[model samples]
Target: DAVDQARNFQEMLKFDGAVLTKLDTDAKGGAGLSIAHATGQPIVLCGVGQEYDDLMQFDPDWLLEQLFE
Candidate 1:
């Protein structure tokens, strides 16, 4: 569904990258990665909490650690 949504958005917008949210949850966050891959766009930012202040630059190392740990 995320991939589908990503594709739909891509069709509708002229954006450069994605802002993935909900990284603080139990979700593995793979959908974000998948969307990036599927759309050929980088993840420019990520949300680690419920606040706007929690938004941060995308970090591949952190995602790798989350996946492997």
Candidate 2:
């Protein structure tokens, strides 16, 4: 459903990239990967907390660490 919605939004907006929010939650954020694969656009940013400063550039290494650790 998220992939489908992302595809639809991509068609309408033609966004260059995505900003994934709520990374501090229990969610492993596999959908971010799915949406990126579906839209062919990278996730440029991620919100790790509820503050503005928590927004950070997307880092593949960090995601890998989180996934493996």
Candidate 3:
């Protein structure tokens, strides 16, 4: 569902990149990976928490660690 939604939005809007938010809430990282793959776009940023300062650059290794941990 999320993948399709992301793909559709990306196609319609033609966005250059994507920001994956609420990773702190979904620690598994499924949505992030799926959306990135479906949209064929890089995840340039990730939101770790609610605070503005929680935003961080997307790191595939870090995300994989979170997913497997």
Q: For this target, which candidate reaches the highest TM-score against the unseen true structure?
A: 2
Model 3, poorest ten-residue lDDT window?
A: 31-40
Ranking by lDDT: 2, 1, 3
For 2-56, candidate 1 gives per-residue lDDT tens digits of 9999988998995799998888884578889899998999999999999999999
Higher-scoring candidate on lDDT, 2 or 3? 2
Candidate 3 positional error at 16, Å: 1.6
Cα misplacement distance, residue 65 of candidate 2 (Å): 0.3
For model 3, residues 1-69, the per-residue Cα lDDT tens digits are 888888889979988778988999999888888887788888999999999999999988998898788
Provide the lowest-lDDT 10-residue window in model 1: 21-30
Which pairs, if any, clash in model 2? none
Q: What overall lDDT, based on C-alpha atoms, would model 1 receive against the true structure?
A: 0.89
In candidate 3, which residue pairs get closer than 3 Å at backbone N, Cα or C atoms, i.e. clash? none
Q: Cα lDDT of all candidates, in order?
A: 0.89, 0.92, 0.88
Off by over 4 Å in 1: none
Candidate 2 C-alpha error for residue 43, in Å: 0.5
The local lDDT score (0 to 100) that residue 25 gets in candidate 3 is: 93
